[model samples]
Target chain A: MKIAVLGSGNGGCAVAADFALKGHDVYLFDFEEFNENINAIMKNGGIFVDGDFVGFAEIKYAGHDIEKVITGADLIMVVRPAFGTKLFAEAAKGYIQKGQKIVICPGSCGGSLIFKKGLGLELEDESIIVSETSTLPYACRVIAAGKVHIYIKLLGGIYLAAIPSRLTENVLIDLKEVYPGIVPAKNVLQTTLQNGNPVIHPAVTLLNAALVEREKGDFYFYEEGVTPSVGRLMEAVDKERIEIGKKLEIEIIPNPVLGLIQGYMQESNYDTGYSKGRGFKGIKAQSKLDNRYMNEDVGYGLVFMSELGKQIEVETPIMDSIINIASVIMGKEYREMKSRTPETLGLSSYTVDELINVL
Target chain B: MKIAVLGSGNGGCAVAADFALKGHDVYLFDFEEFNENINAIMKNGGIFVDGDFVGFAEIKYAGHDIEKVITGADLIMVVRPAFGTKLFAEAAKGYIQKGQKIVICPGSCGGSLIFKKGLGLELEDESIIVSETSTLPYACRVIAAGKVHIYIKLLGGIYLAAIPSRLTENVLIDLKEVYPGIVPAKNVLQTTLQNGNPVIHPAVTLLNAALVEREKGDFYFYEEGVTPSVGRLMEAVDKERIEIGKKLEIEIIPNPVLGLIQGYMQESNYDTGYSKGRGFKGIKAQSKLDNRYMNEDVGYGLVFMSELGKQIEVETPIMDSIINIASVIMGKEYREMKSRTPETLGLSSYTVDELINVL
Candidate 1:
């Protein structure tokens, strides 16, 4: 399969490397400034995949030229966070070949909707098929200029939904070739609500605002920072998220259960049949300040969850509190700074049924 | 008027010294450890008042004897914070005579309710009248031992409402004779909601959590801490407060108007008002590790407000957020540590009408 990987961040580098190692023709395209990174990749001549991208022999290409990357590509994966998803998607719309499937690994909840809205693309824009998974497949980061170090390969069947439902099957086929573990969610809303970042990250981060800001970010955020009380708050927020999901009829695996799948929760804590680690075999974690977890997850993902609650007549005090607190931390109101809200997403006045229909 | 000012903390010393100057037989009582503070009375034998307690005299009656202070007292003003209001009320209950009145200076929205419950008394505990004002009249604290410095005296009618309707007139007469400024609120609920501490303190403290924790007992609390965003949260909380009051058919004052009364907002920038030292008159800044703003106001006050919102079905996201944030900072689950939640206060499952009846 011919694949074009967009964005040269952690997710992009990791995804491009993985696909290339899997004997797929992978052309990873980013900007000129990242040419140092791309040139290093070319010098290395192949990706070093510790888990998913283990073998370096089976490879294709890496570059700053989108024209070369997207030309006759069978699939295009938008691996950037929610902030850059729409821009890359619209850019792809201008250049990509007709019938190229666009897969967003770790769609961060609202990416699919973003593409459809940002580009003014119709649901029946048959040439482009947009699908999203709940999260990227690995707890990985770039080890050096060109080398991506894959850490925990996350597990769990990712949610896959295509625009207009008509092209879903084709997109699913393309993603299945890459990720055989892909689990099909009913629709994009299910995929969006399945987001763990908004439900957990912002609640903990905003609540622990003082701790983080006190000594200038020296804490092991998850291992130590996510204490019992913080976990309870996450549960409170998770309650709201699950409630909204239930209201929308989105099947929500419990947090601990999902965590077991995502490798955050210890499955040994419970007798559930779920395994210990979420095998994120294909992606990396972006540890930058402007990273998705803090910015997009808090801003976009939380906005969607909170707004969905508003639409469904569910009171998400925990979610709203976290959103507001995050906004204050970021020095912007979630309603205004958040790229997607019920208001920004044109769903502020939407009824539950209307929201479901629109999504 | 013979006045027994309970609790020889800042308020206690100030009240004792102020009443003594007014020629009332004022007896100040506290634990024996506060004898060091008696030096303020020893140095000058009374408070050196600049504004309200202007004239200093050595009329010495400050002691740790509760029984001696209560002897022959006409009015015993219970000036303790809400957390200890119950214990003080119960303690005062055993010491009072038939015609004596127990006035909780800022009935703090529901002080009478709490007082009546704590003493195992009924709504018609007519013998001992319990009334409250919106707040303490003086913006004064015992900065040094026994030295109760006065700031701006709040220029509003202090609210008052007796527990039993029968004792309302008698209580008013007693309180007015001493205070000469008691504006009778409609009920205990009215007086309780009149509390501006919950509306102001927690919002500022929690929003400034990062700064407070980072600065670590070095920053100006009320005078320099309340930012515009903090003020917005205050307004949001106040809106919920007013909504709760409306649902319960009680009048709660607006926050901005209250701020205007506090002399913080007078069409001036924060830096200007704060730098020029014109913000928050009567309210001295807290530079202690333990802030009453975070501990009492956020813990006791916001939990009370949150509980009230639950009773009235009004959503107070900001209030709950600040409370939870404060709890995180203090390492306590505020909702649990809070003795004033709707559930704890016996209003947990009350209907609107039922809550109204209780109020």
Candidate 2:
């Protein structure tokens, strides 16, 4: 399989490295950050796969120069955060070759939908299999400029059903060799609702702000910070998310449990378990620096969730409160911004069928 | 003449000393935390007073106990930050002699009402004349345990208004001898509406929390922190206050103009002319350990003002927004607290005629 990765950050580089190591032609396409990593790889021509180590193997191409690297690629994975995703999608729109797969590594539930919308590509626009993973593999980072460190790439979570579902088999066939862990869910609605960031990040961050601001030592995010008071707030937000998920019948997991399933804890519920902050089990979490969680997750993830909750007649006081608080804390007025709402995400008034078709 | 000072803090101690210095019979009551100062004052005789260099003379009477303090006093001023006034008022209820004057030194806008209501006294409770001043007499603090350090005795911006206008002249005769600066207003409405704390505190604190948290080093409370954004928030609050004042037919001066009238500056409005950062000359800037504007002003004063605005059908979105925002920042659900709303203050259900009669 010939593959290329967009974004050289934790998620992007890991995808590129993993595929290249698998004896497949893999290319990493980022803006310019992949250069030193590419340079180091050019010398050794192999990525360091440590955790569950496979072996060092050669990747053919890794560079910021997207066009030259993306040429003749079977699959192109864009791993940028939500903020840069739109811009990267626009660039890819012009470069996409027919039959190529542009899988948004964990389209983060809504990334595929967001890209599709941003490209002005409607539900009918069909040329490529634009897919998403539930989460990226490799809770990983670059140990040095050229080195890739792997931390047990998330083994299983819900990815997306191809927009038409007719293309699901094709998407799975192309990426399964690279990520055997990918599991297909119904649509973007299922994918997005499964977004754990909105459910986790804002709840953890808002509850632990004082601790983060004061001592700022690593906090057991679920155990120490999510007190009963904070838990009630989370439950309120979760109720809204769960209500939306049930309406869509996506089987969304509660946040702390999701962390457990993701191999972060020994237990799955807030009452008993501990989340050792964002670094999943201190195993080098694969999440981006300031990407999907704040933007797509909370931005698209929570926003759409809240909007849908409102549509389905669910009260989301805690969710709205947290979103508004984050907005102010971030020095932005999110209430007036459309980017975080269902209306903006093309889900506000859509019938589920319309949404599924659109996604 | 006999006078009892209910609270032995800066305002209370200063009031006790000022009257005792004039050779009037005076007594001061406070908690035993002031054991050292009280013993010293008992030995040294009374509070130290000064004019222009003919200064620091101990006057008379260190009546540390309540029974000893209230004995034979013609007038007793309940001087405390709205917190202790209720307890002190209830304590005084048992000891207050018939027809004695109880003047609330700087009665917070609703203090007289709270006091009267606490005693189960009727609106026409005229035996004890309740009055309030716009502010305390001296720019002071109790530096030591019992002794107050007076910086400047403000002889201006003081308004005294009795509960029943009938008792106005009777209260003034004694007040004149003690204050020599009391400018009588029509009633408690004028005095209460003249509060400057609510107008200044919320705007400064809410907008400057980051600065306050970042640099506790030499930050001016007034001049530096009250920026344009603070001014806008304050102006909104001030307009609400003035609208309430207008509805009640009292001209409560806005903050900037009040500063000018108090001889601080010649600024007319809060928008531009009044510069913050440098602070009022000779008056110690209110840079307390924590910016207490949230608790002291917003919680106490703005709650009063916001409620009053509600009674008058005045729109106070900005004021409401600040109060709500500050309450969240403080981690309290203050918005739903009725004591925060005008209805709890008896103004919500009051007819225009009833308010006039109560005042």
Candidate 3:
């Protein structure tokens, strides 16, 4: 099998290296501006994996050329921050071959729809299958250039859904050899709504905006930042997300329950679940408010959910409030930015029945 | 002139002691449940003053009897947290003399209206003048039982308005001897909308909820809590407040500018103005989220502003957001609580014109 990973960041390198070590032909690519990691991979001729998956994995090619990376690959993984989804989609416009599969690792609130629209493909088009997973399968990061560390390879609880729901199983079948625990979701909405970064990150970040700016996030994020009030906020946001899913006729797992299933939590509640979770034991908050927690999670994730709620007539007061507060803190109009919304995802005109039909 | 100061809390003790020092006959009263300070004042025969105003001021009366304090008082000052306004109003219901002048010191968003309604008096009742001040005249606290410490006497920027607009000047004339800088406002709406606590306290407290809970507020609140992002949230809420004022044809001063005029700030910008303000130099945050910052500020201040905005068709999204976020943090629905809303104040059915006319 052949795999092309479309980012050189932590998640991208982890996916590419883990699969390459399993004897798959892998190619790594990032934009020319992010050539540091790509250059390091080229110099090392491979990526070194540690922790959960150990050993060196050889890469067949490493470069900045999107065409060279996407030409004839059987599987293409778009693994990066939510903000980069459209940019990568645009870069892969004319190079995508028919019958190829593209998966947005951890669709941060409608990544598949944004990527599909960015590639100038209609939602119903089936020439190529574009799917998204509810979350990335590994707790990992790039320890150094050309070196990736995997903290925990998720044993289960990853949901994948392709555009035009009928083709979801076919795409899952292609990657089942590496990710046997992945399961099919109801549709792309399930994958998009089930991702919990937007539910947790923005609330914690907004409530702690002052501390992050003052102390540069000196405290342990999960242990100290997720206090009772912070946890209540996350529960409010998660409830809204689940409500939106129910309105769409999908059963979206609660974040804490999902956390328990994914091996990230020792408790089954929002407050102590993440604070005492072994999977997030030592993770510190971002050093600043301009990090992806606000930019991508609130900008792309909450904005999209709020807009969808508006379309479906579900009152998402908490979600809308978080977005408004975050926008003021960041000095950016996230709603107007339209980073990801029903309108941006080409679902603005679709009714509930039509949306269910399409997704 | 005779003056009765209700509430033995920080503001009440300061008001009572300052007036007694000015050769006025001042009586201090509090509920029997809060008799520690009252008993101490009775034992000492007065309140010992320090800081901005230094003296031993004799109190003619100190007890929990509402009639004993309100019997023949020329001026009645309700000085307490917003939550206590109605409770005190209930206590003074039958005891308020016909010719007495009642003022809610620092009307925390429609305190006058709430007091007026609680006293079972019509808005147009002219036998008694019911008014409210935009802010208390001093930044002081109770350092010990029967001892009050004054920080600043507020030489300017205190606004006073009566329920019946024509009586505002009469109340001002009575208060002129002690509060020489007090000015007549357009109405109680101006006074209610102009109080800066709702705009500043909840924003700071909500953003620092985790810190307040974890450290029990061991840091300088304004210096460390009012970072750029926290200041931005306050500015956003302030903008909504000023807009509500504008919709009612009142010119609400921006909080930073008001802070400058009230001698609380050394600068005129939101970010550094309060953080580096001379008046707020060493004031620490409340020791818990359940303090008056959340209860009085959000429950009364922002909720009132938001409900008024809804009545007048002015958008207060930021104010609503802060109220919603604060409600989640405190585990109470502030909006539904209706601590001080247009409806709770008896203005729910009034049109904007009718509201302006009655106020």
Please report the candidate that would top lDDT against the real structure. 3
Model 3 misplaced stretches (Cα beyond 4 Å): none
Which lDDT value does model 3 have at A190?
92
How many clashing pairs in candidate 2? 7
What tens digits encode model 1's per-residue C-alpha lDDT throughout B117-170? 776777656666666666787667666765667765555556777775445667
Residue range with the least summed lDDT across 10 consecutive positions in model 2 chain A: A283-292
Residue A279, candidate 2: C-alpha displacement in angstroms: 1.7
Error of 1 at A230 (Å): 1.8
For model 1 the local lDDT of residue B249 reads: 80
What C-alpha lDDT values do all the predictions have? 0.66, 0.64, 0.89
Docking tier of model 2: it is: incorrect
DockQ comparisons of all candidates to the true complex = 0.12, 0.07, 0.81
Model 2 chain B worst lDDT window (10 residues): B276-285
The alpha-carbon lDDT assigned to residue A253 of candidate 2 equals 77
Query: Which residue pairs clash in candidate 2?
Result: A106-A133, A109-A191, A109-A192, A138-A153, B223-B276, B223-B277, B224-B277
A343 Cα displacement, candidate 2 (Å): 2.2
Model 1 lDDT, residue A209, Cα: 48
